[model samples]
Target: MLDQTILSILKEQDQQLFDLVLREETRQHEQIRLIPSENYASPAVKAALATSFTNKYGEGYPGRRYYQGQVNTDALELMVIERAKALFGYPHANVQALSGAPANLGVYTAFLKPFEGKIMAMRLDHGGHLTHGSPVSVTGQWFEILSYGCNENDVLDYEEIRRQALEFKPDVLVCGYTAYPRLIDFEKFGEIAREVGAISLADVSHIAGLIAGGAHPSPWPHMDVVTFTTHKTLRGPRAAIILAKDADMMDRIDKAVFPGLQGGPHFNTIAAIGVALGEAASPAFKDYSHQVVANAKKLGEELKVRGHHVVSGGTENHLLLLDVRKSHKLPGKRVAVALEEVGIVLNFNTVPNASDRQKPLFPDGIRLGTPSITTRGMKETDMVRLASLIDRTINNLKTGKISEGESAWKDDDEAVTIAAAVRELATSFPTFAW
Candidate 1:
């Protein structure tokens, strides 16, 4: 029988850890969580993670395994694969890659040789992920990598990308991004990759749920390989799935994931991913996906009207990048820390064209998204309120209403008032409503 509770046994067994978790939960419930890469796993998905499947060691695919007793594990994984294929329209699914980075490594191991093969991908500070060939990541160190980025206005011009691809003639051409606010044109990427004899690999880990929910265009029938993490907008557990256009390509990827990269699969996370996939396919999740984008658009617009520097002018998807350098002498880290003290939480990030302005550690912008708040049932109007809270906080520092220094926000009375209002608004919505 499937049975569970709200960490009741953990509370009785280890009161210390349980207390810590509850405190974090309270923080989550009371803060405006705007980080783009973050979201709350659904109750059902978390429940799946807590199931008895964690004890198994399924070291291989459904039919073939080094360890026995995979009868139930095999069924669970196969069911998840079918659900993924149905959701994303991919012909092959590898749900055992642990997370996005390994899944990407699986793709590379299948095609490119170590310290060889030219790879072209987007630049990290310009919205691309580290796995897409950042200099610090193994992907960059192991391969010959060239980078592309958004233009001065934070827009990707496909013609420029095509020109670069023609010049570089990479073995793999990568697209998809982390902080990009506009729609990804996968078809254009495919066209350029084919023209240059490069394989089109999209790490759609950020927008996979949006694509599945019809909030964004699908990469299928265009991309040869796609990698996705199940958390974020999918509201799933922390795991990844890779897809191939056909089974022939999947053979290389499968061998790479099992023999080349990982050992036994985390069946607990796999089970949770299955539950999340089920939730993502529902009508309610579809509505949630669109609302997330809608909320982001509204928030970006509201902030823009208040004279904040909204990068790219506004957003077309679930995220917005705000350049504080346009309005403040301090870097974005200061504003981000101040907001955290006031109960709103997000990350400081490099804006488009950051090299011309700030370094990576102290970038000029803050990156925020609507996935977390939208999960709490926040709408466009709520975004209006959120923007006001943000603007007021920024302006408080701008106009000398509050001082800026290390933890100075904790001592300021004006900051106290802002925190009170933020807490009220954040706690007004149920922690996990939608």
Candidate 2:
């Protein structure tokens, strides 16, 4: 809970702003959050982020600072670093980079010279992120990027990937994805990278918590570098961390993150990361991770039973991608918007083989996860209900049977009565804090 003094000060300074923030928080607790990339941090984590540590200007690692008066911040920093290394089994950890993209860039800056090496990563259209060498990113401008794509079975093609690695012979082999619905074989990726003499970097940003919770395999022992955001499934503040297999790489990672990339680090977020890391190490976190996967599988099963097509057939982790167009001939974007109007939240994604010819968006898929909804204490039954609501919404939209739009409801007295009933049904499953 926020202190009364601070709340009073905020009210005096900007009551409207404070009220707006409060409403947003309330909204999150009232609606299901199915986005895999989002989560609600614990009150402890939020408090740490809103603490006085935010005023500090910590420019370097603990016990070695560029600025003064960091004794407490140094302790917080060391706690965060040690907790991360212990959790992930890394020789060294850099908790300075503010987010995942910069943490990845820090790894590249430390290991490879600018414009001198090649980067082989999963194709962005397939599931890879832009920082892995999309043309629009600085990564692509600096290094030659070789991209690999999924095979016809909608799975990673290791043989083709090895062939490409031998053909391009990149200095770095990146293994990770933002929308992949299956488990990653990190050891195989390590083997392939070793065969090509390329450094293996695993961006476990999306699955960090799952890895920590034993819901997924760890890439620490098999990969040379790993990067992740502390938020998302980790349920922490918005922050980044980099783990290296070599202790000698620590200095390089630190330098690249500081003078080579960003300015003063966010000590407050680092403190929150420390708190979150400590929390994640508990037995409860393991249970949470297990539930995350179980809930995802349950949701996938429910969606499939409702006549929807789940990408990769189903999910093995926290997320599931639904090919909405294939199931109902409705665009994912349209379905997503309709669901949002009914108090559900998720994102539209691109599924394999979905083209603009079939749907205006090349890949018409709805990507959802059980992380936040699970945190809200929702189980298989809620997922079934959610999926049924989605199917109904899609069916209604496809048949042009939605008789009441928001504008129509707001203007017409009778339509407003119908809209109120719709909202009542939507509000029956109100979300609550974890």
TM-score versus the correct structure, for each prediction: 0.96, 0.91
> Can you write out model 2's per-residue Cα lDDT over 220-292, one digit (the tens) per residue?
6899889998888888888889998887777888889988999988989998999989988989889888899
Top candidate (lDDT):
1
Put down candidate 1 lDDT per residue, 1-434, tens digits, no spaces. Answer: 11235577878899999889888888999999999888988888888898899999989899999999999999999999999999999999999989988999899889999998889999988988888888899999899999999998899989999999999999999998888999999999999999999989998888887988899999989999999888888888898999999898899999999989999999999999999999899999999999999999999999999988888899988899999987655578878988998999999998887546588888999999999999999999999899999988877664223444434443378888989999999999987886
Name every residue pair that clashes in candidate 1: none
Q: How far out, in Å, is residue 147 in model 1?
A: 0.3
Off by over 4 Å in 1: 1-6, 355-357, 398-411
Candidate 2 has what TM-score? 0.91
For model 2, the local distance difference test gives: 0.81
- Please give the range of 10 consecutive residues that has the lowest summed lDDT in model 2: 406-415
Task: Estimate every model's Cα lDDT from 0 to 1.
Answer: 0.89, 0.81
Q: Indicate the residue-level lDDT of 55 in model 1.
A: 90
